[model samples]
Target chain A: MATLSINSVRKSFGAVEVLNNIDIEVEDGGFLVLLGPSGCGKSTLLAIIAGLENSSGGDILIGDKNVNDVHPKDRNIAMVFQSYALYPTMPVRRNIGFGLEMRKVAPKDREAAVQRAAELLQIEHLLDRKPGQLSGGQRQRVAMGRAIVRNPDLFLFDEPLSNLDAKLRVEMRTEIKRLHDRLGTTTVYVTHDQVEALTLGTKVAVMKGGVIQQLADPETIYDRPANMFVAGFIGSPTMNFLKGTLEQGDGGLVLRHAAGTLALAGLQQDVAGFVGREVTAGIRPEMLDSGDGPASLTGVVDVVEPTGPDTMVIASVGGQLITARLGPKDRPRPGEPLTLTVDTTAINLFDPVSGNRI
Target chain B: MAATRSRSKLLWDVISYVVLVGLAFIAIAPIVWTFLTSLKFEEDIVTRTMQYIPSRITFENYVKLWNQSGYPVLVINSLIVTTTTVLLCLLTGTVAAYAFSRFQFKGRTQLMLGYLVVRMFPAVLMIIPLFIIMRQVGLLDSTIGLAIAYTSFLLPLFVWMLKGFFDAAPKELESAARIDGTTRLGAMFMVVIPIARNGLLATCVFVAIAAWNEFLFALMLTTSQGSRTWPVGLQLMVGEFQLPWGMLAAGGMISILPVIVLFAIVQRAMVAGLTAGAVKG
Candidate 1:
């Protein structure tokens, strides 16, 4: 219901800084995910936005009002914690209605709001049971119900699905996306799971070492990462980084490495100045096909793994290992010479020195 | 080898049972003897013969002690003092413990250490100063005066026990409450306190037991029977030369009655509270 703006927010615990001049903005009804591995300060950033933590410098605005000095209650935000953090002693009905009670809503109105939230979460039968009596997934619903019953201006989730098992995590992830779509409240969710970020976020901010490495749409983040770290962090089986020298060749540019030279096409960004310089070639695992093409790399297969739908083939290109996602039927034995066609248009080239896209 | 192991295990169990039964007898023998002595006639007690059981049981000792000794008033005084001490300790200790568990102030560690240091010293060392202060404050022989004195020592114990329980409570619950629309204090009352109430009850019972049986402070602080606790009254019953063995035994039995009743009432809750923070749910 409200746009959140965090401008140059910094947080330090004593002398050790956890968040470094963070600036992020979410439009009204937008889902922004702060995604990174642990210790990346993504959770700290979310806590700062919720007014649960203070920023050493800068301002936070909810809607149009600066909320840097506001108490968490006055900020009108609801948070779903990773632990579910339900009141263990209260039944689900009172747990969901506690916020309205604190806000001094009338008894009848609070009951109705709690009932509506329970229905939305499909936990009406659980209204009289305490959190300890609920299963992991049911506890998660109660936590969500506690948040949605307030109808607050912002919804903050701190890795709310991380505690569930894998299948439950996926199901809750879809349930959360469905709720967001139905409610359309501006939400800031923190998670280290890239797939969750890709699926749930309208805008994903990939963070590292307390810095925002890349902030873009999920597709852009996956396709055109800003740096080598972003490229390497966003994909499973990871992006292949070929350390080689970039040279001007007959057709366009070619990379010469320990392996045979590979032709590079679709040079979208200018790299003419680095003709004789060392640059790293980035390629997604799924972008490599088994066959010869205009731009291809040949190597000896090192390992083959079939994961039902797709096969992963690891091969030593010179001395560096590269993983390619091939068709399930394309299984080459170890030590077999294999050539893979590179989706040249999707390939990325980065400066080896700075790891920046070129 | 298997036969030898089984034989040794059976022997070990026999030895363990023997040791446990001996310890139980040592603990229970004095109470049993006291109960039997309280039922004996004065002649049976004064005789030179070793009489473990009275030939004829009599209620004379109990009736005389309850009617002539002013024992009921002392019991009432002990109740007032113990109740006041428990309330005072809970009122101050719970807040202090919560603050210690939640906040990181400049001197929190030092202040907590200071509370421990107060308990480290001998209780007798505080008696003179406490007596003088009580006199100056006009609370010298009152039940509230003794209660205040008890709180001074028992509050540290209450705070330390309650702090563990408060620390076991999840901080995330408070954060969730705050975001759900409660102030920090409101969150504490609504979420933290209720979660920790079991531990609070256990701690109250602990302090109450300590105050109830405390004899030294009760004896030193009180001047008259009006303010004296039952333990002091029981000790005072032994006249310089005349020790009324039957009456003293009956009074000992009577003094422990409330403590036994309290334990029976809160036994289950106390055990659950004591083991509360030992595991994660």
Candidate 2:
């Protein structure tokens, strides 16, 4: 129901600055995930948005009005904490209704809202149980129910599912996306898990060392990262970087590595300034396949890691070590020469000095 | 061989039990003796023969202590003074503790260390200055005056112990409460305080016990029954001429009763809270 905008927000704690000129505008009903590694200031940004922390210098707007000085409760936003921050002493029923009660809602109306949220989150049976009595997944649902019952203009989540087990984290991830689709309240979620950012966010903001490296839709963040940091951070078997200088081939520009040269014929980025300069060539592990593609790199397989669905191939190509993803059925043993096909269209180039994409 | 090992283990257990039981008996013998002496008549208590048990149990000693020594008035004064001291100390100490736990202001570490230093000082060393302050305020012999004096001494210890507990309560919970629509102070009272209930309960019992049994300040600050606590009255019962053994023992037992009852009621909570914050709900 509200569009959230942060403009030139800078946060500093005495001598150390945590966030520098953070600006993001989440359109009405947009899901923005602040994605980064640990100490990336993603959680800090979320806290500032929720009014739990004050920005040293900035203006925050919800819809049209500035909410910089507004108290967290008065800002009409609900938050789900990473720890699930449920009242330890209160039963699930009261925990869900606490925000409503704080707002001075009528008891009957509060009960109805609580019931609605409980039913939505499928936690009706656990309503009478204290948080300590519930399992991790159930506590997560209660945390969501607490936020959902508020039905506010925006929802803020601070790594809410990061504490769950891998399987449950996936289940809760899908549940959160489903919830967002149903409610459509503008939401800002923070997580270090790139998979979560890709699956759940409509837009992803990758942060590093208190600065946002990239801000765009998930696919854009994955497929066309603005910098090398985003490209490396947003992938699981993270992007493989090969150091070399850019060269012009007979047909067009090409990235030359010590191992081999990759044709940049289908490269989407402009290669003008990067003509003869040293560059870091990057490609996702998945983009390198076992079969012949438009390009190929012959290397000796160093190790083979079979992870059920896919086999990870770590091979030494020339002097640089590169990893590739292959189908589980194709078993390539270590110490064997393997010629993995590379997809030139999926290649990325970063300036060797700046670490930014060229 | 297994049978021989079992016998040896059993022998060790029996020896350990004998040692433990012997230690326990030694610890309780004095208390038991005092109680027995309190129940005996004055004649029996003063007899040359060491009377382990009262030949004639009498309520006369208890009645004399209760009515004649002005012990009832002293007990009443102690109750009012200690209760008032506990409440005020808790109120001010909790706020100080919460701030110390959550916020880092200038000199916070030094200030906290200063409180710890004050707590370590012997109470007698500060009594003279306290006496001067009491005289200046013209509150020397009043129970209210005694409570205020107890507050000055107890607040630092209360803040130190309770700060450790309040620190155990996650800062995230308080932040959650604030976002849930309560002010910071409101969050402290409603959310943080409730979660730290067991720790708070334990701290309250300790504070109350400390104030109730406080001797030095009570001795110097209070002059008469209007402000005198039980410990002072008990000391008076040990008159310079000769100690009233029966009355003294009765008064000592009475003094320990409240602390024992308080621990009995809240021991589970105190123990439970000790390990509560290990894993969060």
DockQ of all candidates, in order? Answer: 0.88, 0.80
lDDT of model 2 at position B51: 79
Error of 1 at B157 (Å): 0.5
Candidate-wise lDDT, in order: 0.93, 0.90
Those runs of model 2 whose alpha carbons end farther than 4 Å from true positions after fitting are B1-26, B240-242, B274-281
Give the runs in model 1 whose Cα sits over 4 Å from its true position: none
Going through the candidates in order, state the TM-score of chain A alone for each one: 0.98, 0.97
* Residue pairs with backbone overlap in model 1: none
Q: What does the lDDT read for residue A85 in candidate 1?
A: 93
lDDT of 1 by residue, A215-291 (tens): 99999999989999999988888999989999988888998989879888885668889899999989999989999
Any idea what lDDT model 1 has? 0.93
In candidate 1, how many clashes are counted?
0
